[model samples]
Target: MIKIFEKRKIWYGISLAIMLIGLGFAIAFKGLNFGIDFKGGTILTFNMGEQVNQDKVQEVEKVISDFTKKYSARETNNTEIELIIQTGAIETEQVKELKTKVKEEFNLGDDYLVQEENISGSIGSELTRKAFIASILSCIAIAIYIAVRFEFEFGVAAIVALIHDLLITLSVYAILRIRINSPFIAAVMTILGYSMNDTIVIFDRIRENKKKLGKVETGELINSSISQTMRRSIYTSLSTLLTIMMMVILVPGIRELTVPLIIGIITGTYSSIFIASPIWATLRDKKDKKNPKAQYGKKKKTSEA
Candidate 1:
């Protein structure tokens, strides 16, 4: 019995506020800290020959600390610990020396070995470009598909929701200062997929219900459709969220990836229900005023003379 569509302004206001906060942080803080994947650096992956619990992680940190102290201003390593450490952009020779020193200084069990990758900022720049392209293409594809399947209004509303979800998720990163890296790109892409699916389901329902319930106000039809799908959305989002929470707790290395993914899921679900649906109803109503066929206002009956 929630007047979700009737209260569209409230949802829009809230979404705007959240986005503004994120944008404000981005502007004030100058943007998120780019990880090695974006800025380019040396990545070290290793197995400690045991479970990668907190103690093992802390031990690895101590070892890196020792290495940095000896190397002084010549080197630095940041721990993202899932058996991975990032040493800010380094030279080929410095990389070789760092590998030798890691072996000499750190004692992993005889069964273990370390791996390293030297990424250039140029490579990171390429990744950034590719990520942006992928996102834009995805939005375009979704808009086209929705327009073909539903209406132009639905397409625009869905894209608005996509922007809403991504902005809010990225805003969290900006506010929290989470490092932007390849994993962050992966998370954003994955979120787009999830957000699109959730929005599509609601859109599909609205389209179906509009057909069945003729002569109803657009807001009434949308509210009905969203109400029907509410439980499903909650179930889907909650299940995914709990799974991600568990992974973050159980896995030591991928927490960096999983945590942001969790935020994306929640926001994606919310935008689909609260933001996307309401916006669609508003758009559909406006379209109805402009053109009768472009609406859910009243269906063209089969027996019309």
Candidate 2:
């Protein structure tokens, strides 16, 4: 055993060191560039009434930019050019006129239309609220599930580890100034699901070893559990991360989601092995000390009925 628990301070320090950098940027630079989905925006899907090609996409982007420059300079900063979906944080009137100008510039007839989807600020606020609620519920479910299956100590440690993974991922985004959006929230939830599974496997091993090697120190059991599961955790994270990393690098339009996915997977694996399992072992040891009868071989006595 390499004294993994004894050196927990190092592991925890490394995590916080990275996180503090991100926190500094967040406070100083106004945090992430919240995307249209979270900040409310207008989406114009141009039905070109023809086979949409790269040339057409570029033409549409140019026309929209040129027209917006004349009328709404402030709105251009919040704009984006997707294939047919142009999203921006412009006002309601600007959205309608921008669509009309693009149609006129392209000489498109009635058959060719520009569909407008304007998400109001209130709606965006509502979406933000729902996303937070969903995240909270997911965390609660994870804690409850782990407590039922393992011990309450394991549950608390698992949730703490989960928060660690999420904060680290957010830090990466904040440092890079990546926009946080509705999809980002969904990604976080997905990462938590994967993270919970990984943590559970290590916790399961620790529980089994406690049963089999009844007299070992809790730290020694945790070290054994981590070593046993380290390979599986690394391989699973590596494979998933490679695929997403390639997609983020090579894919044209999905950088929004892929970036977060990559960070989340790496953090999830790191937390499972370094943060979650160690915390659980520490808590389990304290629990055992407080009530020695809780050890595997000791059975609580029931009053004679």
Candidate 3:
């Protein structure tokens, strides 16, 4: 019998403290660390014909480091080896120098520099706008679905929990100075879906228990509902987490996607158990207090004619 409602403030306070710290870091750093995908930069592609060893790749990276530290190097997984390097805007001479050095150092052919292009910052701005729109639409759609399936308060509470999970994920990215790339938005959308599903499960339990245990103490009902579903939430999240953790450890190319997934899963599970149900209970209790006659979960009787 976990008293989640009784310790509501404690849970809220803990989340507030963590968020505040993240806000402090965000303020100190001036904002999140947006990567080249959001902030336009130069892209250099080379065809190495064969996959280079780790040491060789490091040597090539060292050459690029001379021009800009904010850069990433990735090799293709196909049969033919293709390396793509991205970095912040650099002078024409610098780009030429970098290309020459890589070719000379690796003893490559003239056609080694296959492609080079500079992306505009405006394109990144457009992407940012689209991502923002997509997130808002997702929230709206989720709220509508939950409201229809359960109730308006349940919908609102679930949205709040989803927002909580998003904030926590963003906090981690800001504190760690992780690059907010295109994949970041995809990760966020996936997080919202996962968080919403977990929240709906608890909300469904609360609805069922309300029918069975009429007029029970609001706090007790909420606590019991959360407690009943807590184990299922934990087990499901843990299993998913283990799979994602394995991806993060073994897969290097997709770390951007997997790392955010790991953070989201943890926060999603926490919010589902600790945030959503309590919020719904609080809202119902407040409404009940405001109007004694129109009490929550109180059925009305019709007058006989």
Give the number of the best model, judged by lDDT: 3
Q: Please, what is the TM-score per model?
A: 0.82, 0.79, 0.88
Off by over 4 Å in 2: 46-80, 83-91, 100-115, 249-251, 292-305
Number of the top-ranking candidate, with TM-score as the measure: 3
The local lDDT score (0 to 100) that residue 21 gets in candidate 3 is 82
lDDT of 3 by residue, 159-244 (tens): 88988998899898888888787888999999999999999999998899888988778887888889899999999999999999
Candidate 2 Cα deviation (angstroms), residue 115: 4.2
165: Cα error in model 3, Å:
1.1
What value of lDDT does candidate 3 attain over all alpha carbons?
0.82
Q: How well is each residue in 1-305 modelled by candidate 2, as lDDT tens digits?
A: 55677788899999999899989989988766666676666555555656655566667767767545322111111133332222443555766687678668877777544344666667778988998888889899999999999879989999999989888998888888877767788788889999999999999998888788777766788888889889999999899988888887676456667778888888998899899977877777677779887664233456987
Taking the tens digit of each residue's C-alpha lDDT, what string does model 1 give over 116-149?
Answer: 5677778888998999999999999999999999
On the 0 to 100 scale, the lDDT of residue 38 in model 3 is 75
TM-score: model 1 vs. ground truth: 0.82
Better of 2 and 3 by TM-score: 3
Single out the weakest 10-residue window by summed lDDT for candidate 1.
70-79
Quote the positional error of residue 45 for candidate 3 in Å: 4.5
The residue pairs in collision within model 1 are 82-253
* Residue-pair clashes, model 3: 0
Ten contiguous residues minimizing lDDT sum, candidate 3: 76-85
